[model samples]
Target: MSFFAGIKAKWNAKMDKVLKIGDFDKQLTEIIADGVVTNNELETIKRLIQEYGLTEKDLNIVGVKAFRAAFKAMMSDNIITQQEESDLLAIKDILCVQNELVTKEMAVLLEHQELRNIQNGILPVIETGGILLQRDEQVHFLLDCSLREERVVRRSYQGGSQGVSVRVAKGVSFRVGQHKGRMVSERDVVVVDTGNLAVTNKRIMFLGSQKSFDVIYKQLIGYQVYSNGLDVHTSTGKTRQIIFDNKQFKADVLQLILDRVTIQ
Candidate 1:
């Protein structure tokens, strides 16, 4: 009906023909059947891509479905082991050779799996909090305000009336009694100066006092390390700089981010 849709349908038809001739679909099924894409399998895939003159779009059309099947096979046990993660990464890397878009799709799948790991409490996390602000799940803290602070405010008020006597025109006198009232109020305010940062299998999340942020591994474009903190750059043209009390944690965090990014 639409121009792009028509093109896509034509492309899919062409790819279907190519796939059948090369038996690419069957080969892909065999490769991922064991939840691992062996070297021989990878070589065969590369050969098929070359022999069929398959473009990145063609690979994407085929690879995504095949990757999903492989992932499901890997997750059939309801748990993803370190070995399984490694195997998935290997398969994703070979797919990346076909197109950059493949990298993004793989990252999303991996991130979803990693998110599941975090939800299951199987992923390790670093808990620290002095969080002043949060955007989404991304937490922000001031380096100088790494320590928590609390303050209390108190207020008091009192009112009183003295007794009085009044005489009316009819020579009647009336006396009024006085009363007093007092009130006090107190409120406690708390400020957070640290937050927990977790690098799960798929994304980086900062849990802060006021807010939190989640930056998926795919969205992270780059990072700059500083003596006191690090600045994370994302594909959305935003940078988040975080300060940690312990400088060593910066290295650990950077490594974790790189590990997640490199796999895809």
Candidate 2:
């Protein structure tokens, strides 16, 4: 037998001995009443299942109450931490409640926790392009290349009181030059190679290009969706536009930005 099977057989044997005492419901209720299932409580539950030869139906009978109690404990503080979310999901799986109504209910909480992790930069967000760059301890949401499109960018520079003001037909860039004994500024046109976009819980990042920039989530004012791409507006009044080959990608990216930015 496999390791798990062997363990199951051992638990089943233990359970058979325990069933003779006939306190399964009482023991299960006691374990679940605290609204949290600790390691010992989980072991006890496993033993009860093994002893009673509990099938899915019997498991759900006990599981529904335990799931609710565990979920309530996690939500008691009005915020579910990553550990709590993981634990609850594990409990749901172990209780064989995967098909229960409570499973769907807990999914919302799990999704919220996932989004929360992304927003807090506790997760790594990644998008595939010509290259992939990732690090530990970062949240990366990868929007596939099916959603990316290329666009031509043009730029121009004009001298002003503030300095040389450079503007791009697409995004923004800066260039330094000397004119008439003063620092003359000119608009620097950016040439991007193998560009892709990614949104993390903390920021929106452009990757694999010289003009790559990371815009923090807090600085994002809003985004507009176009048939081919998306336009992201920052708090600085600058807008970055990205065109995707897929229209659905445009919509999905827009919705992702809206969902992420609104929560923060």
Candidate 2 lDDT tens digits, 108-185: 575666557655544434445444344532444445322232443444444534345567666876645535334434
Output the lDDT of residue 115, model 1. 55
> What is candidate 1's lDDT per residue for 1-264, written digit by digit as tens?
999999999999987777664577677788788877667777887787677677676566567677677778877876666667666666666555343545654554565565555444444433445433234333212222132233457777667667698887588888788677677667663444456555544566666667567687678887766556566688998766666676334353354444544364
For this target, which candidate reaches the highest lDDT against the unseen true structure? 2
Report lDDT (CA) for all predictions: 0.61, 0.62
TM-score of each: 0.36, 0.41
Global Cα lDDT for candidate 1? 0.61
Q: Each model's RMSD to truth, in Å?
A: 15.2, 18.0
